[model samples]
Target: MKPTFIILSFFFFGMVLHLHAQSKVDSLTYYYGVVNQPKSNIQLAKAYNFFTKQKEQSIKRKDIEKAVFHLRLLASIEKKMGLLSDSEISSVEALRLLDGMTNPEMIKENRIGIYNHLGIVYRSLDNFSKALEFYSKSLELVEDEASKATLLNNIGNLYLDKNEYSRALVYFEEAYEKSPRLDLKMKARVLDNLGLAQAKLTLPGALSNLLEALSLRKTIDYIPGVITSYGHLSDYYLDKGDRETAQDYAQKALEQAKQLNNPQYLESTLATLVLLNGTPEVVQYKKLRDSLEKASVRAKDNFEYYRYQFSEQQRLFEESEFKRQKLFLTLILVILVFVAIYVVGRVKHNKEKLLKVYETETRISKKVHDEVANDMYQIMAKLQANNETEEVLDHLEAVYRKTRDISKEHSEIDVEGNFSETLMELLKGFNNDEVRVIVQSISKVDWRHFSNLQKTTIYRVLQELMVNMRKHSRASYVVLKFEQKGKSMAIQYTDNGVGTAIYKKGGLQNTENRMKSIKGSITFESNNDAGFKASIRI
Candidate 1:
């Protein structure tokens, strides 16, 4: 009939009722009924095994609600069996599951239950500070009047155990006054506890409240409540120096304890009887207390073993998860790096192939100019010497000039030496009576900073642009401006010609490809109202 025993009894009763109300599955309902039954130690062990297996299976299936539910029940059973450490472990595990749940209402309700359960477990373990901590946490989350009343009563009992009678009375008073009146069983608990706190402080109304609680417990036929009320009444009378009445209540408590077949209740009742009866009862009480103390020591040892094993397992799982995530990220990074390298190598190979084609075209142009053009010149000279017609000689001479121009367009130049002078000479070649070509800032560029391939690309792109302008623009004046900006070079080409819509084709497309090969860029702008313009950046 201790406060701790009453609290635990109330907890199990509520838990069983809750499980019965919520469960729809037949198997689950059967197990709930089996666990709640007052049976032998063997039956209780079987119930524990069933819930443990259910919890494990639920976790494996990732059924969070079922897992948490089983864990909470497991904690309650463990606490009932006096395995305080195991109960603490079970309650904490349930709370861990609740942390990841997305349902707010479910999480809040389950958290309050688990916190309250942990408080009880800690209190049994004699960890008073930890008990208060969990109790405060549960109080913070509880909203319903019934839950508030229950928690307030439990807190009052805790303070009572600590001998803080005034503080216990305050909590008990508040619990009794809370809205939505408690049920007969809960009301009796609160009233009984309130009376005890008052009696401890020698306050008024203690006897009336105690009698009322006893009357309510008898009305409900709740044996545990009746036993607790009797025990409290005995203590109350004993405190007031009424040995005869105290002895009478203690005898009644002892009879109820024997009928209940609960060692804790029997042991407590025997201790009280020993206080009233003296000598012979004292030796019997001492033996029972020693046996209970030895059992408690074994339970404590078992708790320590379970706690160490649980902590070790948890640590190992977290370490394994950390390593797995790190390895996964490392694999992803390696794949990305290889992909980037392959793409870069492919682009480099294509650019080299393009540059090789350009070099081959230059060689073919030099061959055509040196061999076929020389043969045509010799043929024209022979025709003039043989006195052929003037028209024939003129036609042959035109063919020679076309061949020479083709050679000039694809001719190779010294891009690595005096690049600026070579570039200027190439631009000057486009000058004629029909058009005036002007160049600016050509000497300002640091030509040596550019690679051979980059210089070649620039030269070829410019040659193509000039050819396009000459053939299509019909411009009277052209200006090519070069400028250096930071580490890059820029070119602006403008022509005051009858402007036309810009199209990407023929020589213009070739120019774009050439610039792209060297990782440079070009843009063209033109309209009927404005002269043609191009901007190049490298």
Candidate 2:
């Protein structure tokens, strides 16, 4: 795996382990609570005795304190996993069990050192008032700086969620001021939250916070966080009226999400791409959307398994009315899953098919350019090189021109359906020593016609575009246009050369003839210092 991927996997694994630990704790809590309940007094009393009873006489000594320690650790894990329900109940039970222990065991407040986690659960559940209550209580009780920092973070989270940016900043700032190692989880959380709150208060999308967010997110490979920052950056640029920059950042978010294979990120990206539908940036958005669809299908399959499990659980409970309702809900979910899966797949396939067609055309065009008619052209060059009789020389010239004409006459269109690749190749060739070409506006075009002949004519016109620029214009950079103007197609080229009028010869006049054959007309604009420019209309 790449270093980046390994790091991401590590973070993801940490998160996954956190979840598993939380789930195990939830299961343990449920089992223990059932034992402790008022309805099962006999079992509750037995289990309580089993847990509380300690032995110093045996090798395999029973340790109730150790068991409760494990339970406390589990509750902290639940709080980190965003399992608000599990964290809340588990934390309460852990606190209750830790109470009444010998003072030497707790030794100040070590026995039930987990109120910060309770605060976290409340924060996630959107009970900020309760969350702050728990956090303050924990702060007063815990002497450990790390635990205090965790409480501060929990309080910060509550304020942040409530959109109280100034308050949130204060909490995080305080947490950072204390021990940075407050949690086994990454330390960047404080910096990240600090930056976000700062951005909200300062600007719609401030640079400093966003840059910090990007650096940290990239370091940890936090896919959600990275996408979020990129999204903010995109919006920032868009709001600043830098459309290209905004568009670039937005599209980059789409690309990064696609590579990560995160369907959730892609879903967010697609909404942006749809907004940029007709622009060059839309291409990136479309590409990611197509990939997201494939992933969403797999997600649906997983959801189906969950639905099945839920159904079994409902059936076992013998709650017929609830079961009926769950069954209906399950059926509806399955259909929506199928439809979503189908739509995503269909969009993906169409994009693939389009790309394939583009590739095939490119291959054919390359063959014609480098392989076909090559030997004949070489032979013509060799024949022209020889010193011979006038009649023989005339014969040679006639044969060469006739062969060229024949090749030109029977020319078929080379349409590499891929505009992106085609445009790249065209631009590469357009750059040479004799002609300096400035070719912008080369991407994400909606071609006027899909006909093979039309594509062929356009390719030749472009080839002629380069030829004209090289031989005549003495251009520094060639600005070529392949655009649709209303009902007609227009092409323009400008260059810096000595002012000159139309003296049609070699490739320039020949290109003019070719243009006429395609029913296209060429016009020239020139200046003494600015040199010459040409535009063609079809």
Candidate 3:
């Protein structure tokens, strides 16, 4: 009876914890959806607790994937709350789960999202090198033109932080022009950033862009954006020594900042107001500024302490899991010596052949992605900007030449000659001097048995995988193995690069769709430390 009661008590405690987690999650949803301009640390803290509790439950159930989801959420929340280092560690841990994954499309999505978030966090921390790396990695995964434009804007912001105003202005312009009409807020932000960059260079269009951004913010009733625009206007006027206009905008910003009750903005507003004043209100504003600064520092310190505790606990847990896995793998390896010897010999033979082919293909791929692609992009930009018909024609002619060059390159591949050789050559392009690649079982497959459609699907799928790996993974080594089982064929690729987070339905999804179209299937696995892997059976 005592044992039964103890078990029942344990069950009841689990139920209570589950209920508490659900309550917190509900509160998070309400705050996210129902509250306007919610920026309280309390709100963010509640979100952090919710995910942390969920992560604990997931770990208890041995659901590493679910734990990853919770960790990613926690990371995003910590970032929003200004806990930079904690956010970075949480994102890193979330990515680590992908090491042994089989279907990483979901993880890839999570990874790219967290990568972008980490870039923002690093930028806020003024760590430009890390920020640029994360942004570049995120850029590699971005498919939509709008997403690319957004990343370009962020990268421009990085340049702005470095005071490279001219370089910043170029990226901001490209982002603004590439953004669609529907994304007016994004375009307005881009315009605002561009205006600031232009102002640094003393350019003509600075005022025009700022005013346009202000008008758009007003149209959308974006209060925070309005505050930001007002601040910019105040700074611009102040720089020009127009004290009256500067004070007016600063007063407006102060009023809005007070209404919003944001300590950081209020402090900024007060500082700006103090800069343009000798009035009695200046003394009062200064006092408020001092108090807000003190309170903000305390709050930030407390939050950092909390974040450290949570992250340290998670780190200990992950370290323990890693040790266990390492021990288990070591034990297993001890029982497979003969099989490992044969595998190593085969891999060495394939590596030699792959290296010779890789060099030739790398040259061709570089010519396409670097030379032709860049030339076409520059020409396209020029065509869009030039108003004169003759100039437009010249740029259009350049675009045509690059397009022809690409067509000629593709035509060099003989689909009828040998599909296996062609496929191997395609894989070869993904390798470089920094990374070693080995492919096996190419000769074992009878290419003549497969239909043209099957061969095409296989080629395209592998091509996407290799291209994605090259773009995002700073991999040191890669292995591709093929296996034939009855009428079905399986191809696997393993790479030692940064692992993926949950993937969205992007390139991998497109690959999956293509595979499904041909009654085939595909899977992916990755982790931050172990790298990325993909498998396809057709």
Residue-wise C-alpha lDDT for candidate 1, range 453-494, written one tens digit per residue: 888888888888788888888999999999987669999999
**Per-residue lDDT over 178-225 for candidate 3, one digit per residue giving the tens place of the 0 to 100 score:** 857427788889899889888888899998999899999889877778
For residue 28, model 2's alpha carbon misses the true position, in angstroms, by 16
In each prediction, how many residue pairs overlap at the backbone (N, C-alpha, C within less than 3 A)? 0, 9, 18
lDDT for each of the candidates? Answer: 0.84, 0.61, 0.76
State, as a TM-score between 0 and 1, how close model 1 is to the true structure: 0.51
Worst 10 residues of 2 by lDDT: 50-59
Top candidate when judged by TM-score against the true structure? 1
TM-score of each: 0.51, 0.33, 0.46
The positional error of residue 277 in candidate 2, measured at the CA in angstroms, is 10
Give per-residue CA lDDT, model 2, range 248-340, as digits (tens): 888989987786554546777767756655656676767677568545533332222234447667767678777888999999999999999
Question: After superposition on all CA atoms, what RMSD does each candidate show versus the true structure?
Answer: 18.0, 35.0, 37.5
